[model samples]
Target: MRTWRLVRVVTLLLLAVSYCEFFHYYMVLLLCTWPSVSSVQGFQSHPLRAMFIGDTHILGSNAHWFDKLRREWMMTRSFQASMLIHSPDVVFVLGDLMDYGTESSSTEFEYHVQRFKRMFSTPFTTRTEIIVGNHDIGFHHMINDKRYERFKEAFSAPSVRLISVKDVIFVMVNSMALHGDGCSFCKEAEDALKNIKWQLKCSKGKLDQEKVAEICEKLDIMNYSRPILLQHFPLYRTSDSNCSTPDAAPLEEIDIPFRIKTDCLSKESTDLLFELLNPRLVVSAHTHHGCYRLHDNGIPEYTVASYNWRNKHNPTFFLAELTDQDFIINRCSLPDEHTVFTLYAIFAILLVIVIIIPPKKQKPNLGKSFTPSNKDH
Candidate 1:
């Protein structure tokens, strides 16, 4: 009986440990990332106050407005608190501004994009950059130039554009064009890369060659000014090359497609780009999973968790405090519903255990019956 009791104790301990780990993540979702609690405005002197959210996949319509409204409302509050405190200048959406790049016409898609813009216009106040993802261009499919052009114009951005603010320059690139598989916009993408390289080399800390490079002088760019590279894909799954990894993680199948594996960036191109670009920081969205890790070369890279709750993964995003040359990444995505649901699950299992196992009844009846002689009954 003692041995059985010891086994039971050990089992309980193991379960407790497992639950403790689960509880930690649950609390983070409930407290740190939950949108109900509006964010505190950050300091004003912050260089660039921006929120980075990924893969909204918002199904914008009357039927789903409630969910959309609540999520964005919470996000706005969070953004405001970030601004009130961190003082971000804008929002950088990693990509997939539309829900139906797969089927919707360019005009329809553009309308949706504009709607998205208007939705955030009130809260965002400043500029909000919407990067294009595979979903925006049809995942793993060649992009239609006509559609991509319309999308770009609607957003009033180039295939690759640069934004300069407070000694920081943000370079946005369309990775769909960079696939190097004879994509329609491949030439434009190649040109964009060349332009970026030239701008960085000749302009030296200035977005325009004509403007004086005060930022370069102030930040001492003669040495090396690491620019922030934004895109929709990652270079590597595990290694720390400044390139992107696949948009999706490796599946459990025996064989996967070559294109799928290198869908984000080919190893050869990744290596060349790293040598040419030398991006100090890499930010991307594709994988719903949230990640922050340094490249093998030491540049920090991140994949913000998807904002949409429709995915199998938990909703996640990050509070990026862009410190001078590096980034202070604070992940805030795991949400209230997830926590509540997890808690309920754990409780349900425990309740079932209680219900299923009968309680230990006192063995008193047997003792009394056996002790009849002592009672002299």
Candidate 2:
């Protein structure tokens, strides 16, 4: 009986200790480390400047942590407040702002909407544009969620949106609906896809050729000599896939996984998208692993890392400074000091739990001489 009692006490104590440690880890992660503004060494002013961010994936249950991190990074203010402290002409979010679409409740959806409203609240000299990602569409395998519709309602539009800033045109397209079985053959969506497809395609495929022409025509209409393309998925090879160069190392060699389902866009669609847009530069993020490559075609595509729990060391953003001679792209990491401190704080909490939950004590047994039969005799 005594032994059983001791074991029960030990179990209860351990459970209590674990609970405390878990709560402490989350608290420190959300509130302890904050980011500060830092300057890029050789930033230059452009006729127009733009800042790009993607794959935020904020939710009410876990948004506080993101909010804390964003606040630290000085992202809650205008773009001009940070690296673009001079004030960028525009801000673009590539996609995946929320984790899941319509399945996300009103409260959860509103939480993400509010976070954006707060983060980019500063008056911008340029426009703010957003593209839809796979998560924003909800269940890309099927079109039943209608989450994209909700997102449109919250964000104010669907399909493609064009912004002309400082005589430069920025085209933001919804890539989620293109290849997903859920949206296959959606007439309106198909038409939009066809329009984008025609502008990008350059070869024998009618759809591809049409897309390329359309994009060129759009540039003509804008009369812009240089444009920038922004999308959630990259048109080039993904981090997990085989590289174009035989000498290149595989993704795993670089600490990236072979497949990240949420980040992948079909190779066929990406090739088509890249071929048509042919922008001066392309920026995207979904792979979580940051990648910078100048394709054989001379187009530069950059994938920004994420600011989530999974990507602890790679929370990052891009700074593009336009100069007369050339445009410079700088990939910057958020403060590492706070992240390191947070990690230590978590370790300390776990250690405390171990110390507080004492091991079970062995109970003393009654002697055989004290048996009931002997006592009776």
TM-score winner = 1
Model 1, 1-377: lDDT tens digits are: 45555565567656755554344444454454211221233443454555788777655444377766656554444344444444346778888765666566656676677667655553445667778877776654556667677767777666677666655677787766666665557767777676666566654544654544533333323323557888877665533222233322334421333253334566655665676677888888776655566767887778776766554345656666553354555666444456545765776676567555655665555443343366554
lDDT of 2 by residue, 1-377 (tens): 55665666566556554544343333432332222232243443434566667776654454477555644333332122442343455667777776655456777777768866665554655566777777777535544536667777777757565555654555566665556344543445556645544433322233455655665556324333344667777663546343332212334555454442345556666665555555677777776556777867788877776644334443566656543224566565543436545655665665566556665677788656643565544
| Candidate topping lDDT | 1
lDDT by candidate, in order shown:
0.60, 0.56
- Native-referenced Cα lDDT, model 2: 0.56
- The TM-score values for the models, in the order shown, are 0.64, 0.61
Full-model lDDT, candidate 1: 0.60
Off by over 4 Å in 1: 1-45, 60-87, 122-125, 182-184, 205-224, 238-263, 340-377
